[model samples]
Target: MTLRAYPVRYLPGEDELVWTGGLGVTVRFTPGVEPLTMADEVDLLVVTPEDFSESLQPLVEHKDSYGVATRLVTLEDVYGGVFFEVRGRDEAERVKYFIKDAVEEWGVRYVMLVGGRNGGLLEEKWWCPVRYAHLDDGSNWEASYLSDLYFADIYNPDGSFSSWDTNGNDLFAEYSLMSKDILDLYPDVYVGRLACRNSYEVEVMVDKIITYETTAHGSEWFHRMVAVGGDSAPRAGDPWYEGEEENKAALSYMDDFEEVTLWTSDGSLSGPQDVIDAVSRGCGFLFFDGHGNPMNWATHPPHDEETWIDGLGVGDMRKLSNDGMYPVCVVGGCHNGQFNVSLLNLLKIYEGYQHWYSYIYKGEVSPESWAWWITRMAGGGAIASLGYTGLDWFATGDGDQDGIPDCTQYLSGFMHVNFFWEYGENGRRMLGELHGETVADYINAFFPTTEKLDYKTAEEWALLGDPSLMVGGYP
Candidate 1:
């Protein structure tokens, strides 16, 4: 099949150009504060009139599918070649807008561009300054509702610095000073700096240093920063899944679980309400497997809008104020667990959603690994609550027969077992561990009348598993 391409060319000294239908136009610009290195590959899409309809169909159809704005470019017959300027803005934004506009305007479909110097557009908007500061006072503050703030002092380790403004005052000035220091140390870090209105702080200095890489200029660096750390929520089965042997092995492990419900689909949760109803019916754990984006729920295209409470704002998906009792929700897809504080601000406006465990993966992930993780978790393994492994298993053909495709497999084998195990084990472990009762005592402790388990507090119940597991609560 012929693929469409978006070609972005840089022309030095020329403001614009005139192009016939067949000739390519040049875009004049430079790399922002941080130059695009060999590591940073710019994606280009080129589209012509022939494929315009085909190129735009999916985007137009899925407009609010992910809840974020998607950009499209339609290039007119430039009576004169258009000027793609990247002056004044920071490097990152400059490049981003230039490329974004190019694709949106010129009907580009395929992306191929030379890396480094004299070829691609140089833009300024991409640069943002990085700041480091030690708060004068030891109080901690929330920088922004949905944004993440990194706090650390150059000198201290344990208690050296904090990001609190005890007086409820904005800490923009203080933040700017620290940012200036970061800029001074790494001039190419960002195009410029801005003070944070909220005084959010990071407790660990090591974490602060690492966060700077994310806020830096290049896309490669930003993606790398987001991919770092053991922050990803765990999956159910073993980390490796081959053919039926692996599948049978994984399934055998799941025999200990009392109940199991497996939901499979391409990448959307078409029956979230049914699952919710089951959870409300006292199903303990809920597992979802499929393709997922960072800020929205993954469902099949032509989403069932009726399921979402109209006009309800968002914080957590569970807090949508549905009549059913919320089960422990687990998303086994890529990026579902990931949350940005900035995005949270958007959710808080809605009433029905509140804070729930949203374990996120940073990049592309496969359904097979998800399947393995789920099965293992269902069988009583402790892998589901720790670490992120983004897209590492795609090359392995771990679970699926055809290998895992990039399309969101949101509800396939990945979501089935994990949800089953989590819900089944919920209240039982609580009384046994929290009350210090023997396994026999705990077994006998179940109420004969209701067959229900009781716990004194949520925290005590939540501490049933190894305290070290990072993702979900213990119980």
Candidate 2:
């Protein structure tokens, strides 16, 4: 099939509005490129990287106005370059994966592929449909691993490279080994780890780890790795030892509230009974700190006894079980705030009333930060009443002895700004009163504002905030 490329140029010296009108009609005509002129075919519009910005503007406007799903294809390898340009490589990869999936679903072929510095030597090759075909088949193309690899040598604004090998390698090796073992047991299963730079690395690691007659081994392994059993495991212990002081302080703050209920155990409460009871008693924020699986709820061992015989696991959060005054559920766990299909489904089951924030990483969170987050909510700084706290490092508020621990405060402040600026402008202003200027300013002032912020500085800045803050409270 011959692909017709549509190029929209913002001609200089020409009337911008007129140019936009002409561009819109030109884009509208692009749907005729495919042989099968179906609704789905019309959905796919291919454009070069140069035109991506302009082309997407119209599509975004159209979608907002009419609620239509129009997929756009950019030849630019947004994911591959992301590791070089951004910090969260895993997120970058996820975005890329999502784009690929959307393109495939729209029945589109070929994207104008560009190469990044670490995109490997193969990326230097000219854009070819065969290369695109290989990626589609998952045969000859390189598989994604995680964001750590791409950001292994992040660049500084002054052209210096930030070495993240020491930290990243260790994490990657462990995750890789674990993935390999899991794939070895179940060869057909898809195994992937989320990476930095908005990407996810997925590759077939092993041949098999499970076999007949070894059912016990398989079961044990599955339970250990995948099950969300109660908080008995070593990993379930509070990872933030630095947060002892802040945690104490937060507990002190909680004393002012009526009833502070901390759901530290794993697994879903039996048939919403606990939730019902809490609601009946008019409980405050429902705080859940425990292990969680995307599809199964595994309570701590002893509590499992109370579970229903046919009760739903994590997968059943979308189904009806109990109805009453619902308290906002704050899931201090991973991937709970994905804002994707799973969360949408969860919304459906809860009659779209339950507030949920999920997908919290353990390392980037702290008791103190959690306390501050809830305190802000209780203080009426926010009205959404539910949402996941973004990634944060667990640390004591007194580690640096300024007020909040530098890392915890910075991340908390950043996420607060990001969330409020995007979703709650008023909330952002209120948070600003507590934390001062926005996270973007904080990041740019101290950290290297280059294509790639050196991972070392990134990590350091993540901990210490702007270095100027170290000298004085005012930057």
Candidate 3:
């Protein structure tokens, strides 16, 4: 069998060059070219709908006063050709192009997207367009999942525009037999989203950010960390406490903080009330490792995958009253970050039982994902959260033949724990920086491919909070 060479062109006239066993080789280096148009440097760029701009102003001011150098631009500014030249196949692409320009022209290091479904729960309109990745893993009900990483990965290693749709089929992030786009999977700029469905939510989140950053410093609650888990996959055998092990890994990295463990092994995590009670007390960080869906996160009792333990659900968010002391939550599960879900899906489901099953694969079938609800909760809930937008995967055994269980290495379990590791060991103070660095580090450690779960692992994992967030608040 002969191997086919895949050539990538980063600049013009690259295809014209042909090297045929040259007698002598010469290398030339050129100085970097300056930008043709320079704009005011912006450290954090907040992209929101016009309706949200007013609500987000306080957040911008707070960031500026804290020396983050933030600037707010609406979706209108991007699409109307007011600031950035409108150019892309769709609105989502156009938004991505604007982010690319912001990185180069305005020197933007972080991007915060603050918008969600524009209308009521039954409406399908979006305040900020979302990009869906068409990476089918056959086992999952949905072939596509929401991916914000597309906006942050601006360019490939070759310096070419990293349009996720490299095949030009307009199907972004395809990783199936039908189509596959080789992605760089490296974040050029740190990106996060608030996914606020309305202006009220925007105001609530802005207030939360301001209060957290300004007053959270030196608070004893900020030094506490809550870690909860149960048996994630008992079928895998042996330890029978995969969830607890993952949580322990995160706690290991967070040695400075007081650790609070609620595990099935100890019967502390018997029900959702346990989670609600623990979170109400307030802590700097919350790590939940288990199985999850759009509305709830659940797990099995130790060594028993059949019996389910409803850990936490969207409905339980309201029970939290940890106001002024919010934890940055990291959830290890599936569909917890599926921000595309809307109330309109219920209408489709009401049509009939047949349509209900069919619509599940098409996506958008929930009022809100667990991560979004937690972040948008008025007085309590997590200040920020990271979770998967679709079905998550973990190695059953030593899939990589690396001696250690692959589940503990580079899929859902590893990504969830690494966020804390990056914060504690690597000293990634900014949430987005920690998130972006974690993605880059994961890709570096496990070379992702179209057929491998690694690609989807990196693509589907998303952050729901300000990318410029200061973990444990600003000092």
Q: Write the per-residue lDDT of candidate 2 for residues 364-388, one digit (tens) a residue.
A: 1111222112211221211112222
Q: Candidate 1, after superposition: displacement of residue 305 in Å?
A: 20
Summarize candidate 1's per-residue lDDT along 242-308 as a digit string, tens digits.
Answer: 1112222223333443343432222212344533333334322333333343333332222222232
Deviation (Å) of 167 in candidate 1: 40
- Stretches of candidate 2 exceeding 4 Å from the true structure: 1-71, 74-313, 320-392, 403-418, 421-442, 445-475
Give the distance in Å from residue 426's predicted Cα in candidate 1 to where it truly belongs.
18
Error of 2 at 265 (Å): 13
Each prediction's whole-model lDDT (CA):
0.23, 0.25, 0.82
Candidates by TM-score, descending order: 3, 2, 1
In terms of lDDT, model 2 sits at 0.25
lDDT head-to-head 2 vs 3, winner: 3
* lDDT for 417 (candidate 3): 73
Q: Write candidate 3's Cα lDDT for 356-388 as tens digits.
A: 666564334657788989998888998999999
Q: Flag the better candidate by TM-score, 2 or 3.
A: 3
Instruction: Judge candidate 1 at residue 98 and give its lDDT.
Output: 40
Each candidate structure's TM-score, on Cα atoms with residue i matched to residue i, is 0.24, 0.28, 0.89
Instruction: Output the number of the lDDT-best candidate.
Output: 3
Clash count list over all predictions: 95, 47, 0
